[model samples]
Target: MSSPRLWLVGCGNMGGAMLRQWVASGVVAPDRIDIVNRGDRDFPGGVRQARDLPDGDLPDMVMLAMKPQQIDDIAARYGERLAGVPVLISILAGVEEAALAKRFRTGAIVRAMPNLPVGIGKGVVGLYSESADAAARDQVAALMTPLGLVEWIDDDALFNVLTAVAGSGPAFLYRFIDALAAAGATLGLPADQAERLAVATVQGSALLAAAADVSPAILADRVASPGGSTREGLNILDREDALKTLLVETIRASVRRNAEMAAAARQSAVGLGRITLFPFVLSLSHRPSSPRTGTRRTALRQAQGERQGGSSSRNRTKRLSWCRNGANSDCLEGAAMVPLYP
Candidate 1:
């Protein structure tokens, strides 16, 4: 089958990662993809990049990699142009298919949650779709095949749970690696040497676990043999299921936050108007800088103009109030949005 012609909206970290892998794997040709991002980014295969969508027929697929908060704005700007795209895939965490359908007209809407490792083709992509038929699902699966293991989640709630696990799993693993290295250093090993050893140990262990036929629990038992050093350590971690409990709590917290963001994304002007200042803080901190205007202030002003003039005028007063409150220098200088979540 011919490679699907694609349009990628918002080519930031995650989008860039997926694009590189697609070109490398020959799953999608460079010339067949178009990227619309706020600013130019270096990408493999010299794929075309522009601030606006290309003029002509819509591509075979349109992937939304932008912020969840920007959904309404994106729809306002390009919904008409993308009215009949065969598939609309979103990597915006916490945003649902129903939310996408409400804003944009498309043949099918698919939610894809891909992790950072997808850049190296070792990541996990959890997909969930209610409207896509077998043919569309197969097409999406084929496109995502090169990135990593593609899982189709049967339940949307479970898909959110998977997002907490596989989607946000890497950062948690990184924390574990750091803590392991710190523990090693505390035990009198040289800091740098301990870090190197810790990293290598974890890397090798992960590879082994991946190759093993048995479950991780069984593998742990196999490594622990009666009263060895590994067993002593395992005893500490397994005591009252300390490690498992901590991880469960961690994932639960993540799941809760994902739900909050999903709830926020699902809100319309009325719901948005009722939200507290925290959401404004998120918007102010995470809003992208415009290519036309280099500063956040100008970009925000542009957004204010758009929001004031855009379809929903009901929340104009409330939104403007929040915008004014968030215009402080401290908030404007905050870090850019992490592509992983809202």
Candidate 2:
């Protein structure tokens, strides 16, 4: 395949890390990449950096790496310039593929979600695209392979939820590591020593889990003897399934917010007011998982209220189910898609 001319806007932290990995891995030479930012921003040692979309011909591929909140400015300012590009990849959170199609008349738009670990070629990227064909899909996948395990999400709506899990999941895990270290320090270990051990311990454990042929549950069992220290801590977490409950709410919060983002992206598609997820009684057995009480009526009233006020919110029927006896027991995946208006 011929290497496509690349254009990047807002190559900061998350985006910068992806680009840095691309360059370091020798997937693309320094000179082949072009960066466009607000100012004359400094970049990795190599690669061409431009103040604006290079004046003349459009690039073959244009990617947006700015924040989701900045999508409006990004769409308004640079959208037209990159229109009709063969591929437009967005790393912005919450922005949907349909939104990209409207902003930039691209052949295809792919949402590429990457975490910080991509810098050292140890990241996991979740990709989604409803419009791209087989070849186009392969191209995107190939580009991401060097970074880490790349999976293409077949359903678009699931993007946000998956993004919530994979994209935001790292920060949650990192915080766990930090909390563990701090707890160690609180128990009398030196802070500096505690931090090092905590980080290394997590890294090693993660590697072991990833490499192990057995499941994590089995692995945990192997670590805890008939009556040991690991078992003591395990008891605390296992009591009434405390950890699972805590994580359920944690994941629920992220998924709920992702729906909010879908609303945001849809709002941008049309010049309508913001879209938000009304906390409605979302009963999976029914739909919208609303609480069992009078809260459902209140949420519905608020949704109606928004429409009357010129903004509209819809409870895109969300249904969740569990079948432990099926394929993967503890594994929970979601499907989230927002219909696009022409």
Maximum-TM-score candidate:
1
lDDT of 2: 0.67
The collision pairs in model 1 are: none
Question: Per-residue lDDT tens digits of candidate 1, residues 1-342?
Answer: 898999998989888889999999999999999999888889876589999999999899999998776777888999999999999999988777877898889999999999999999998999999999999999999999999999999977666678889999999999999999999999999999989998999899988999999998999899998979999999999998889777775665456445445544556733332233333445544442222322323323433443454443334344445445643222222312333263
lDDT string for model 2 (161-233, tens) is: 5776788888889898899999999999999999999999999998999899999899989999878999999
**Candidate 2: residue 204 lDDT (0-100):** 95
- lDDT at 44, model 1: 79
Question: lDDT per prediction?
Answer: 0.76, 0.67
TM-scores vs. true structure, each candidate: 0.81, 0.79
